[model samples]
Target: MKLSRILKEVKINSIYRTGAKTIKKGGFRKNSNYDPDISSLHYRAQDVQPGGLFVAIPGLFADGHDFIDQARMRGALAIVSQKPVQSDHSVTENISQTKAKQIKNDLTVIEVDNSRKTLAMISAAFFQNPSEKLNIIGITGTNGKTTTAYLIESILSAAGLKTGVIGTINYRYLGKVFENPVTTPESLDLQKILDTMQKEGVTHVVLEVSSHAIDLFRVENCFIDTGVFTNLTQDHLDYHGDMDSYWFCKKRLFTEYLPSGRKKDRAVAVINRENAKGRELFEILPVRGISTGNSADNMIRPKKIEHGLNGIAGNVLTPSGSFDFKSPLVGKHNIENILSAIGAGIALDLSLDHIKAGIENLFYIPGRLERIAGNNGCFVYVDYAHTPDALSNVLGSLKAISQKKIICVFGCGGDRDK
Candidate 1:
């Protein structure tokens, strides 16, 4: 792809020619003669290859601008930075004058107002905007995002649409799975994965969007068709500082990103009406809202629910129709997850039969109330509930179903909110 094409939508402050001389004063011009063929896009200096574009991000721990010289040494043709690349003498201070001049002469540095947002736009452009080619369902919140994403994926798969998933456990499509280091990947990796999924004929994708990813502009260019808000709780306060700041980050998925999606005209928000923050988000959403909960006023709710050690069986009432569903997933919290998935199914115009089959087919999600055989007729279950609210919900569910005394064991990690 040409540099001009990759930066077509990027907001530029200035474009610097070889030797750090100013070429264009503002933005990019389609008819400009400085368009170079870009082979790839990378943020890490070590990953830069010949003819690649490197984006310098000012991260929390380390600033990528410090490695501009390394990127140039690795044969990067272009550099994108929020700060003035020429004004930073630290990048060339250690090198000999001849080598420093060569480095500058071989580079085309473009200054942008925000490198994070620019990286997203250029990545989407470089990959031909794969999100637009697929129906992306973004699930955001604190506790139930992973399970809700799995349910949505199962439902979409039951509808006979080839699907992919990017979530807490892993990223998988067509029998290929990649380890997930974060709930949401960086923009470059995300676009590349979506592009691969699109080429493999995936029609829909279910993504678990994290607050950190949203705030960092990782999902800024994703065209979400359905945005699902499961529920928010007291978690990640170490990073977000307060509940309000965390809520604002999660709300951006629907308010800021969803409205600019490819299916913006049909974009829908599947909200957990039982949650106070979710209810507030539903009221302020710019697109259509599909409320899900046990409340009578919810658009998607459970008509009758039965919970036991074996699993949960219930009839879910939705705008499309009522469907009897059974799942090996236990707990009242999973009821909210089921309703959210059903609402997502309806938003995508899926048949109730498909939704029912999808719900019943998924037997388990790892570490989410996973049952284990125990000695002396004891039942042991493992769950990944770390927050106070999540732990309370798990214990509450167990209390409701178990007649015998229940023993609970848990621990907290370091560097997290107490």
Candidate 2:
């Protein structure tokens, strides 16, 4: 976009113009009112190029400002930063038409109070505000985010909405899937993905928002139409340092970011109230709260769940009505997952028939209770249970169905609290 349009309502802290000394008069636009064309935007200096804008974000380890010379080497058209970056940007031999004509000696540098927040907002502006075109659902908690996201996408898609998903496993849309290294991507990548989804006519997006993503400002400014809190457990204490701090980060999805005052009937917090933390959320959540569990009044309830190592079959009772729900997903914990999915379906205004169809239709979840068989008459299940709560649940389920001795093997990370 034209630099003028990009900066038009964007709040900036300061401005620094650094480059070869091409200035003849006032601001960079003094000579040419036509804004410099910014072809692409990035947060890392390594990704900067001739016509790109680089955002210098201060991180835990290496700070981005330290790499200004590297970005300038690749012809960074503009640099947005929080810390003062005093770089003597040497002249480049090859330059874009806009840069050659608009800037003679210096590069455009816009300083912002908060680079991370500005990166998110600027990305939205550059991408033409894609989140506005899609109904985004942000799911957060210690576990079940990936499974809940898969279940939500399935149900929403069955209801005739073109749905996309961003989860621990992958980011998928329109029959295409991309490998994801994190539960939520950085702000720039996220905006780009949402923009792509909007272009492909995707109407709904389900994202598994991680606590680190929230704390690190990775998901800033992205609109979440609905938020789901699966449940909180003791995990990520190393990063958050305490259970309260960790829970506080997850609560942002429901209390701070979710769309407010839309409708109390259309609940925002889809929670498993059976969990103590989830039950606490049900009491404080503002817009809407849809409880899911075996409780008498859970809007979506799992009654008499019949589950084993092979598969799960159960009765799902929602306020809209009850229906038979079954899934190849193993363990009783999956029953709560089913209830969470059903609650999401209800919140999205989907019919009971579609909800039941979506849950029963999904036969597998990769790396999550995935089953493997051997010819030697033994069964094996692969589960991504890294924390104490998750390991206990998986082992408990396996032991419940084993006719012989149940053996378990697990490990903890080197630096993490065990």
Candidate 3:
């Protein structure tokens, strides 16, 4: 695509063309495009190139603005910054007059209100707006995001849609699966993944939206078709500063990003009414909220639940209809995960039977209530529960099923104030 197209799509404030600084062929000196065409989108200065777009995003430890000189030296043709550049930003600024002039001639700096948001918009545009081509479902909460994401993926696939998933476990679509260090990837990687998914015939994507990702603007413009709120609890307080701030961050998914699209109905929200914050979010959701919980009047609820070590069996009731919900995954806490996924299915307008098929087919999810053999018929299970509420739910569910005394062993991660 042309440089004008990328800038036009984002409507950036300014674009200044600089002189060409040539590089050795097949080496670092190989000059990138002298003009507006961009070969890539990057946030870090180290990754910038002559034709690459470098977004100066402010971070907690280091600020990209401080590394403008490196980006310029690395041949960054287009720079996205929140403010105008200063001559002292680059070490090249103090270089010999000839080198400094050539550096100046080779740079094009664009300023914007928010460089992070700009990176998202430009990344999506650079990837040819791939999110718009797929049905994206975003799940947010302190817990249950990964489980609900798995459930939704299975449901979409059962409906004959090729589904890709972006969650805590990994970002997977089509036949490829790769480890993801973060719950939600930054805009450039996210847009690139969605672009690949679209090309591979993936019709749906499920994303786990973490509070950190939301607050940092990582999920800025990858418009969500459906947003599901599993529940919120005491978590990430240090980073968020308070419970209110934490809830506010999670609320952004329903209130802002979820509603941006041509079809208002497609931008549906699935929330857990049992959660105080979830209920609060439901009221503010841009679309008609699909509230799921034990409440009789909720849009989606479980009429009857039967839990055992084998699995959970329940009659799931939704606005579309009611069906028998069965899953091999254990724990009563997972009931909330199931309900949230059911709401997602309802939002997708999937038939109740398809939802049932999807839920029952998922036999297990790794490191989540995974059962292992123990001596003398004793049972052992592994889980990834860190928060107080999450641990309580897991232990409580296990106690309910086992008549024998239950012993608990857990520890918080290093440096977690909670």
Candidate 4:
């Protein structure tokens, strides 16, 4: 496809340059015009492939202008850059692109006010609206997004559909999983994952939608099918500065980012009825919502909460009826987790039996109430509860059943949310 063809489907400001003979002239092009078969669009020069447009975004610490020459050198069909336009001959000699072939590729560069948002839009067009074809579940809140996403993936997979999950712990697909250090990856990585999931016949993809992901527009233009709110607590103060901003950041999942006017019947929201923030989010959902909590007063309630030194048992109350189950996971917090899972299962039209089986089958949650063995009858647990509410819930649950003193040994990170 020609550059003119892509511009017709999506708006294009300018075409600064196009196909060159070699990397020195501009960059590598499989041919002359853009490739219609390209899998995805990317911003970083390093991620560029044949015919992909390399968006030169000005980052916080490093300006993307510095990498434009490199992206072109590496084979960017076009450059979406923020740097004040310098004549092609004026590229500073100080920056070297020896690895990008000879001289930096003098490809076409599109100037834009906000390239990040532009990248997202171009990606949506390139992917032929893949997000619309599948159920994209976005789980937000200070805590439990990852766990909730994991539970969603497990429940979906247990019901016999290939499920994909992207969160702090890892990005999962089929039976294979990759360790992901970030709660949410960049937009390009995210779009790539969505594309792969769609290609592999995945029916559902659960993503841990972080406050940062929302703020940076990493999930821009990708419609969410269902959004789940776990609970909001005192976290990310360093990034958000205050609870109000933090709450607003998490709220974007439902209020601002949900797909607009797309048959509200297909969209659903599952909220933690116990959390005030969750209630606020529930009020904003476009369609009818499901509420989950251990309290009997909850709309989608979890009853008969029983926890011991061994495991936890509970019954989930749905519009249909209640289904009892046992979970190897312990704590009232875990019960909250189960309730959220049940709500999601119902939202997706899964059977109570399948939901119960999925919840019960999940015995391990890494670094989350993760227990360790010892010689004596004593127990040691390692958890990733970095927030006040998380610590309170875990400690509160253990305190309820302890025959002896329940002592907590903990410390905060050096430069993190202390």
| Candidate 2 residue-wise lDDT, 1-418, digit = tens | 8876676656866565664344322334644533578999988888887888888887878878776656766777788877655434423234445543543435677877888888888888899878877888888999889888888888987888899999899999999999998889999999999999999989999998999899987777777777888888888877899998998988877776764423324437788897998988888887777899897877887777788767888787788988887788888787778788888888888899999888888877887788887567877778889988888888888788778876666665555453
Off by over 4 Å in 4: 1-40, 82-84, 89-105, 261-265, 294-297
lDDT of each: 0.88, 0.79, 0.80, 0.73
Looking at model 2, residue 85 earns an lDDT score of: 51
Q: Which is superior by lDDT, 1 or 2?
A: 1
TM-score: model 3 vs. ground truth: 0.90
Clashes of 3: 10
In model 2, the runs with Cα more than 4 Å from the true position are 19-35, 87-105, 259-267, 412-414
Choose 2 or 4, whichever is better by TM-score. Answer: 2
lDDT of 4 at 264: 45
Stretches of candidate 1 above 4 Å error?
A: 18-33, 87-105
Q: Which digits, one per residue and each the tens of the lDDT, describe model 1 over residues 321-346? A: 78798899999899899889899999
Clashing pairs in 4: 16-108, 17-108, 26-105, 26-106
Poorest 10 consecutive residues by lDDT, candidate 4: 19-28
Ranking by lDDT: 1, 3, 2, 4
- Candidate 2, pairs of clashing residues: 18-107, 19-106, 20-105, 21-105, 22-104, 22-105
TM-score (C-alpha, index-matched) for candidate 1: 0.95
Candidate 2 at 418: error in angstroms?
7.1
TM-score of each prediction: 0.95, 0.89, 0.90, 0.87
